[model samples]
Structure formats: structure tokens, C-alpha cells
Target: MRMRKILPACVLSCCLTGLMAPAAFADGCPDQEIAVETLKMKRAEDSEKAGKLKEAFNAAKTVAWECLGNDAGKRREALIKRVGRTLGDQEEKQGRLKEAFDWYLAAGLEADADRVMLKRANAKPDDTNAVGNAIDHFKRRNNEARVREMRGIAARNVDKWLTAEDKAFAARKDSREELGKARDWVYYAEAGSGKVTERAEKRGDTLATDDARRSIENAIAYYQFADKPQKAKGVRDKARKLGDEHARKGENKLAVEFYSLAGDDAKAAALEKKSEAEKQKTESARQDKFKKDQQSLEKELGL
Candidate 1:
């Protein structure tokens, strides 16, 4: 096109071109000939080779912040994670905890940011909200051990916050859409001490066990009414566990109830038979006592 636009590579890297670098990057990427994302990766990689870690981080972060979508999500995600994490280390080394936390989030590496959340959690054992917040990142990462650890902290506190969360689901329990929310609350609450099925079976505390039973029952009702068979089936699996445990513990009625709810007709039928036999034996004993009492009354009255 223009003569000035036709410069050789050496002429482009002169002081004039070097001074133009920032403006050129600002106006558009350095190379319009290459694909934008590829050019961006090259810029960051070049900065890294030159030991300009911040520049490299900024280049990759620009893509993450501005260019993210199907392409970046598929292709450039690892590069974004790398540069962001590398810069986060630098920031943390400089004692910029908040900055490091921000960088970790930008990298989509919430597990790294969890290190900062853990600090706040340790600082405030009684702060259930803090523990709850700390658990969320690990939950996203599917780190069950860390989530349980955070929930354990929340369990010890047992403040109004947890009660509010527990009651929130109860408040909206009747709506079909809200049942999943109820299950979520139950998951968080019972996951702390034990799962709802486990708690129901333990029978260690009357209030806790009753609450678990009611929650599971309500969940079953909601699932049936909502036609959510898959979710219902999952809860039924929980019911099976409770049924076996109750049977082992000699709670025949509860065992039969749970087994029926679990759709285990054979187990339910067996338990029901045992329960019926026990009922008949108790009735026979009652009749024998009644006859003995009648005879005593007649003898005492000289009838």
C-alpha cells in the first residue's frame, strides 16, 4: 500500500518503532497478519522469554478479560491460567494478598484463592458465614474434603446464619421448584454432622433424627409430585440405606416404612410380616391379662 508501511523487519524495531510499540498495542494487537488470539499468546510468550512477567500476565489477562468466549475457552484457557497464577505468586510474594486473590480468580483457579479464604476462616471460627463462603470455592472444584472441613467449622458455630439458611428451604418447601433448594439445604446442613440418611439411622438425638426423617419424607413427596423420577430415584437410594439401618437397629415399623418408600417390595414385605407377628403376640398377651383380671374381679366380689 503505502511506502512507509513497507518497512523491513530491522527498520521496524528501531527506536521509532520501539517507541511506537505501546501505542501500536493500544490501537490494535502488534500483528494484524496473525490470528488475534495466536498473536496475543505470542506476545505473552515473548514477554515471558524476556523476563517481563508482568507484561506477559497483562497480555494473557487482556485475552481472558476481553476475548473470552468459545475460542478462548477452548484454546487459550491454560495460558490464561498459567500467566495469572504466575503473576499471583509475584503479588503474594510482595504481600499483596488481595491482589493475589483477584489474580487467582481471574485465572479461574478458585482453588488457589481458597488459600486466602482459609486464612479468614481460621481467623474467625465462630463466623459461619465466613466458613460458608470458604466452602463455595471448594464445592465448585468438587473438593469434598475441603468443603466438609469448612462445613465442620460452620457446624460448631451454629449461629443465626445457618438457621436462616436451613429455614429458608422450609419456608418455600411446598413449591415444586423449591424442593431442590430444600435438598441443597439438607445437603449443606446434614453434610456437616452426617448425611440425612445417616443421621436418621443413628438415632443419637431425637430432634435431629426426626428432622432428618421429615426432610426425607418431604423430599419424596416433592419428587413424586414434580415427576422428577431421576432425582426421586436418588433419594430412594438414600431411603434404602435408612431402611437397612433401621432394620438392623430393631425399629421394625420405621424399617418397613423406609423400605416401602424405597420401592423395595421384598424387604418391605418381610419387615411387615415381622411387625404383624409382633403385633399379634402383643395382642394375645393383652387378652390373657384381661381374662385374668376378669376372674380376679369376680372372685373379689364373690360372684
Candidate 2:
């Protein structure tokens, strides 16, 4: 009985040792390039499954570059793509967006890379410094669509900052310095994204335009209430120009609002009158159309 137990134990130990031993490269490929690539690719997959991403990434880098050029049969291409995608996902989850983007690109996934970059820009939409950095990153990469989107985000963040600043200023009438700092952020938003304001206006987004106007009005109120008319001159000029531009476009109501903000009571009142007249004129035209339709129906029926 003892001899039988020892024989079984020795057999088990030999089997375990063989299984744990490093894999031989003899069965991989006859060519050196193929052999090296095959070995590294297998190692990469194993390391990744074992949660050793750093080792996986290093191994994958070698396989992704070297294997593609060596393997004419495209044997390792699928594994290389898989490794690149996996590394990108891991890096993105860790907030390493730049690395993730590069990995995705190397995987030949351009759309995935762009999406990751956009997410990076949107990650800190409410943070001025962070959003600014994201915008700069997109700009340097010549991503025009992403730059525009980032600018819109920056403008929105400025609005949020202005709202908080408004509450603080209201609570403390002596918070001129704080208000001035808030105005600087507003300026930064406009300066950082030259097209944001123009695009907002052209898009006819009522809420977006209102948000922008409110922020600018807050700045004007701050300077005017602080008895600094000279300092508010530039803002007043901008408001006046906006009003004139709206009036020329036949947006009399918006023009009136802007003129009022500029402290141009006369221009605002005149624009308001024009808007009322235009509304009445439009109503009258609708009524006339209704009457004409009724008369045509009566004539057709010989009523």
C-alpha cells in the first residue's frame, strides 16, 4: 500500500512541473521574426488576463509593431488589434486619455480615438483651467469639430461661474473685487472661443443667448453699480453693437433688450414700438388671409 501511494505522488509532481515550465518556442514558427512575435503575443495575452497591464502593454507594443511587418500571412494581426483595443480601454478607464487615444489610433480605430479625445475634453467641462487645457489639446491636434464643441463647453462653464459669482455679489455689496475676477473668466471664455458667441447667436438658441446676455449684464451691473462708468465703456459699446445688429436683422425684440442693457432708453423704447407695430401688422395679415379664404369658399359654393 505504501509503494502504491508513493508512485502516484511522484507521477503527480512530474505532471505539475511540466505544466508550470516556460513554453518552448520550438513549436511557434521557423522564421525568427514570426517566432519572436508569436511568443510575445502569447505573453501579452497571458499578462493581460493576469491583470499585469504594464507588462501586457510592453509586450503588445512589440507585437503590434514588429508582428505586422513580419507576418505576411496576417496571422498575428487579429491579436495585435485585440491587444491595442484592450490597452486603450484600460488606459481610458484609468483617465490616461492621451495614452488611450494613441493606443486606439495604433489599433486602426480612428473613430474610437476621436471619441476618447472628446470625452477627455468633456471630462472637466466645468473647470476653466482643465477645460482650457482640453481645448488646447484638441486645437493642437487640429480637431476643429472638437475645438468648437470644447469652446461651447467653456462658454457654458463661464455661465455657471458667473451664476455663483452673482449670488456672492448679491450677498456682499462690497464684493467688487470678486465680481471683477468673475468678469475675467467671462472674458476668458469669449477670448478662448472666438466663435462661441457668434455661433450661439446664429444658431438662434434662445437659452444659450440668454445665458450669455445674463453674464454680460452682470458684468455691466457690477461696474455701473461700483460707480465706474469708464470701466464699463467697453461692455456698453459691445451691447450697443449687438442691439444694432439685431435691429438690422429685424429682430426688434432682441434689439430692444440689448439696447436696454446698454442704457440706451431711447433706442430701446423706439425698438419696442417697432416690435409692437410689427406684431400688429402680422396679426392683421393673418386675419386678411382668413377672410380671403372664407370668401373664396363662399364663391365656390355660389353662396
lDDT by residue (1-303, candidate 1, tens digit) is: 576676764586696767865533423434342357667767877887897877877787665423334554454566667878888888878877667877888888887888866775676665545566667767887889888887766554433333443454457443333233323444445543233333222222222223256656666665454455676677778888999999999998888888887889999998899889999999999999999999999999999
Q: What is the TM-score of each candidate against the true structure?
A: 0.33, 0.39
Q: Give the candidate number with the greatest lDDT.
A: 2
lDDT of 2: 0.66
Worst 10 residues of 1 by lDDT: 199-208
Error of 2 at 214 (Å): 29
lDDT of 2 by residue, 210-249 (tens): 3356655755655554455664675676788889998999
> Which parts of model 1 have CA positions greater than 4 angstroms off?
1-35, 46-55, 61-82, 93-98, 108-111, 114-116, 126-129, 159-303
lDDT of each: 0.65, 0.66
